[model samples]
Target: MIIEGVKLMFVGMTTVLLFLSLMILLIQFVSFLTRDATARELEAIQKERELQSLKRKKKKEASADSDEDIAVIAAAIAAFEAERFART
Candidate 1:
């Protein structure tokens, strides 16, 4: 009967709507449960990046000191060469 078909359609639609709503709720619950852990992971990655940045800054400073030493060595070599020519 047409009336029975209409009733069946509505029932089916309602059932599907309820199922979809339940699925959405379950997904939201899982996301909420894992939120803290995800936040912690992000914080740890941020800390690691900060540490790497600090290490790079220290390496740059050390390299600057070495550059000064290299300059001094070059000057000493130049002076030695000049004295040797003066003596010859």
Candidate 2:
């Protein structure tokens, strides 16, 4: 009786193992079929990220340049006014 029970347990285990293996293979095959689509999606995502980063960098640089230009203009105007007052 014990031997029969052991045999039954092994059979059930083997059947489950085989089913799991088949499922894994099917999943892999599906993934392989969609590989190109997945790669394209990944590439597009990477490109979008790069573009966003570049845009952010440009905005920062433009703001910094504007600040510097404002400071330089203010200094030049102050110097001109000081010279005009001295002449008077």
Candidate 3:
């Protein structure tokens, strides 16, 4: 009985190892076939990311410029109010 169990375990382990090795080989073969397509997809994704980053940067710069303009306008208004109060 002990010998039978050991033989069963060995067979099961060997079968599992064989299946895993074949799966690995199949994956390698598929990857080799699709390598060019995968590279193109990666390049396109990178370009899209770069464009999005550039758009975000431009938006940030515009927001900063607007903040400066608002500060200038507020300063002008404050000066006008001070002058008016002084005249009164």
Model 1: residues with Cα > 4 Å off, grouped in runs: 1-26
Q: How many clashing residue pairs, candidate 3?
A: 0
Give lDDT tens digits, candidate 2, residues 1-88: 9999999999999999999999999999999999999999999999999999999999999999999999999999999999999999
Error of 3 at 43 (Å): 0.4
* Cα TM-score per model: 0.67, 0.68, 0.85
lDDT of model 1 at position 31: 96
Between prediction 2 and prediction 3, which has the larger TM-score? 3
Q: Per-residue lDDT for 1-88 in model 1, tens only?
A: 9999999999999999999999999999999999999999999999999999999999999999999999999999999999999999
- lDDT scores of the candidates, listed in order: 1.00, 1.00, 1.00
lDDT of 3 by residue, 20-43 (tens): 999999999999999999999999
Of candidates 2 and 1, the better by TM-score = 2
User: What TM-score does model 1 achieve against the real structure?
Assistant: 0.67
